[model samples]
Target chain A: MRVLGVDPGLTRCGVGVVEGVAGRPLTMLGVGVVRTPADADIGHRLVAIERGLEEWLDTHRPELVAVERVFSQHNVRTVMGTAQASAVAMLCAARRGIPVALHTPSEVKAAVTGSGRADKAQVGAMVTRLLRLAAPPRPADAADALALAICHIWRAPAQNRLQRAVAAQHAQNAPKGRTA
Target chain B: MRVLGVDPGLTRCGVGVVEGVAGRPLTMLGVGVVRTPADADIGHRLVAIERGLEEWLDTHRPELVAVERVFSQHNVRTVMGTAQASAVAMLCAARRGIPVALHTPSEVKAAVTGSGRADKAQVGAMVTRLLRLAAPPRPADAADALALAICHIWRAPAQNRLQRAVAAQHAQNAPKGRTA
Candidate 1:
């Protein structure tokens, strides 16, 4: 499956697309950052991010989109900007009927570097080796985006299977067409 | 100016439109809530919100759109959802080229009830009195939405003048071919 991962931010949003399946080496379809001026109004910045995401969606056409799940931060302003940018990414995928998944930073780190506590450098190194690239992607956010895509690509299958099994069990226990 | 106020939330988003100038009596053009099931997927929920806000914008065609500024909350998940919904509201207004404003909760309370620390009931009462309605609007979120519209209507004139004064001062100090 081809997956697009987004590391959402107001000033600089990282975007990367990877094509791969279980037990297969992934191919880098594209990677880049979408930037908006810091001095611009919040609404205008959001619009710019939306336009950038739409362009990427049109050009790459990834099957799935993975976005970083926003968590609380000490800096309320920074967190708000990140959350806003993250929403735009999800909305872009939804508008196109593309499935979107959210992965926490820790989950991405664990998936890519075998540790939830892995630092940015470790995650970047692992991503480089996994993608067989000559060097790690620059601008930490770009590498982080690739890690998110790899995490979702590796985790989604197992997650989907688990969901289906739970749904089947619930269906068997339900009475008539109603869920208990 | 006509203003549409949005109180963004994941499960229940309140939307209201009011028409008036700073010193004139405001007319309530419309007021309602957009609700999504808690069990729905996040992407679907966001799309539902985007569609709902877009419909409101198209129908009301307000000159200004006012959204409640999301603040950091102790609950990370709740804050994330609110921030996401708030972004969608801004995006809708920006897409239509409608000027958008964000009012903090305290600012809305202060403008409507004369106190930033006023409770929800007090704000509701003030909104009801300001709109000359027999009763307060149902659901606190709906009343808060109206309060936001009122706050923006009352504050925007002063804010605009201040901005223009700053621009004028900068223009006078700038070089012939550039702005400071």
Candidate 2:
């Protein structure tokens, strides 16, 4: 699957495209950052983000996307922005019929560093080592984004997704289903 | 100063471009809505929003942006998306050397409807009437965005903005500057 990993932020969203064969090597397609100025108004900022992503999407054509699922508690304002950015990312993938996967910070950290509690620096270090790159991914955010994709790779089940869904539904509605 | 106002959201973000003339009308240059899928990941959703905004920005470049400062209770996920979308919008405008103006929801509402307690429907009605359009702006969210632009126009005095800033700073720092 060709996976695009994204670190969504209003001002700066990091994007990384990685393609992997079922049993072969995973290759890095491309990596870059979409940045917006601090003084731009909300409308313009969002537009800039769209434009940047469009440029990347045109070039990468990722078949799937992995984005970090936010569970942050920083405050209302901060959380609001994070969620909006996430929503925007999801929308882009959905419109293109590109399947999307979301990974928590802990999941990414664990996948990259073998520890769920790993910090950004540690995760970055591990990402660089695993990818065997010439340099560590700059702007910590970008590295985390790549790690998120790695986590999704490890987590995505091959053929049991539907089975789990039915099982969960059966468990939740067993009593109600009997009544109906 | 020309200003673009944005009402950021995942499903739809409202964008209104307005140009301020010294004594002429507040020219409504353009208005549109950027849409994203509701079920998409936040990252892809953001990409869609960016694409929509980019088209508008390329068509009409406003010099300043006015966005409603977000405030919400409950629904952390929703709030997070809004905030991130708002940030992206801000970055886009700022990158083009546009100054950003943030107005509180109450401030925008009061300026548009002369009442801080005005509901969304009331604000939408006033905006439709104020713009003197053939019909009410569809997708209340878009009208809400125009209202934000109108609010900025009404709140920003015609006098030199720089001088006003200095005087306002003085008033805050020097209590003696207050007339009362």
Candidate 3:
């Protein structure tokens, strides 16, 4: 299964594509950051993010998009930007009928480093070793993105069942003849 | 000028359209809520919001879009959803080349009523008076959306100048040959 992981941020959204399934060697397809001007208005910044993400989606065309689930407990100022950027990432994938999955930061770290509280360097080192790259991807965000994809690939079996149940419940509870 | 105001939320996104300038009597073009099922996934919810906002834009053809500025200091769980929804609202407007403006809750309150700390009922009453409506819009979120439109109309003169200066600064500082 091919997966596109997104470590969402307004200033530097990290995106990486990984191809493979659980219990198998994964190939690192690509990794990069989508940057938006800090001085730009939120609307313009969001537009920029959409365009950048579209370019990535056009190039990679991954089957699933995994984004870091944002939590409100982070830095108050940055958390809002994170949430907004994540929304754009998810929207782009969903619009294309690509399944979107959300994984927590700790989950990503644990999947790659065997510890939820692993430092950036450890996670980077582990990602480099796992992907058999000459060096870890530049910018911690890029490494985090790869970690998210790895986490999703390993956890997909369980996550898929949970997602299916949730979708079924939602469909059952939906109002009659209401579009949403 | 006609302004489409959006009070972003995950479950019930309030939208209102108001027409007219600062000193003139305003017209309430429309007011309604765009709701997404609580159990729906984030990507689907965002897609629903985009569709709903697009329909409003198509019907009203508002010159400008006004959305509430979400702050992370609010209810921790709810603030992230608000930010995500607000991002989708801004994206819809920006993609169509319509200028988008953000108004804080306090700013909307102060523009309509005498005080920034005015309660929802007070703002709703003033919105009814300003738009010459028979009754205040139901659902505080709907009233808040109308208040946002009214606020933008009243503050546009000053806000436009500020926005222009900010835009100019951003343009000046932008990297050469760099697209954002």
Candidate 4:
């Protein structure tokens, strides 16, 4: 499956497309950053990011979209922008009927580098090796996006199985006469 | 001018429309809440909000949209959801070319009740009195939404004048060879 990963931010949103399946080699389809000026109005910046994401969705046509799950930060302003950007990504995917997944930073690091505490350099090096690229993608965010996609590709199967198991257990435990 | 005020929340988004000019009696065009189930998927919840906001925009056709500016809250999850909802409200307004304004909760309270520290009851009472309603709107969020509209109606004139003055000063200071 192909996945478009988004490292959401207001000033610079990183996007990368990866095509692969579990237990198989992966290929990088595209990678870029959508940059909006810091001085731009918040609404306009969001609109720009929306348009950029739409373009990526249109051109890449990934089967699923992976977005970084925003966690609380000491910098409220930064966290707010990240959350807004992440919402835009989710909205874009929903509008297109494309499935979207969110991966935490630690989850992504663990998936890509086998260490939740992996440093940026280690994660970048692992991503480079995994994708067979000559060098790591620049601007840290781009590499992070790729890592997110890789994480989702590797984890989705296990997650889906767990979801199904829970659903089956719920069905078995429900009263026989329940309509739901 | 008509204004649509949005008190954005993930579980229950409060929306209200008011029509009036500065220094005049305002009319309440509409008031309601758009609610999404807490158990729904995040993407689906966002899409539901988008649809609800779009419907309000289409039905009310407000000239401006006033959204409560999301601030950092002690509850990170609540703040993130509020920020996301606020972004969706802004997106709806921007998509329709409607001017969007953000009012802080304190700003709304101050505009309506002459005290930024006013309690919800005070703000609701003022909204009822200002709109000539027999009673305050139910659900504090709905009342807050109306308060936001009233705040924008009252502040727009001074804000416009300040914007124009700033623009004029910039124009006057521009280089002679520059054309703007």
Best by lDDT: 3
Tell me the chain A TM-score of model 1.
Answer: 0.87
Give model 2's clash tally: 47
Misplaced by over 4 Å in model 3 are A161-180, B161-180
Q: Write the per-residue lDDT of candidate 2 for residues A1-180, one digit (tens) a residue.
A: 567888877777888876664344566677777887867435444545656765676788776678888765666555555565665566555545456677888888877688999887898888777667778788887887777766666667572254335434533642211000
CAPRI verdict (incorrect, acceptable, medium, high) for model 2: incorrect
Chain A TM-score of model 3 versus the true structure?
0.88
Q: What are the per-residue Cα lDDT tens digits for candidate 1 across A49-126?
A: 888898898899887789999888668999999999999998877655667789999999999999999999999999
Pairs with backbone N, CA or C atoms under 3 Å apart (clashes), candidate 4? none
Q: Is the docking of candidate 3 incorrect, acceptable, medium or high quality?
A: acceptable
What TM-score number comes out for model 3? 0.90
TM-score of 4: 0.88
* DockQ for candidate 2, C-alpha atoms: 0.16
Of the two candidates 2 and 3, the one with more favorable TM-score, higher being better, is 3
Ranked by lDDT from best down, the candidates are 3, 1, 4, 2
Residue A70, candidate 2: alpha-carbon lDDT: 74
In the range B83-172, model 3's lDDT, one tens digit per residue, is 999999998776665678989999999999989999999999999999989999989899999999999989986775565566455446
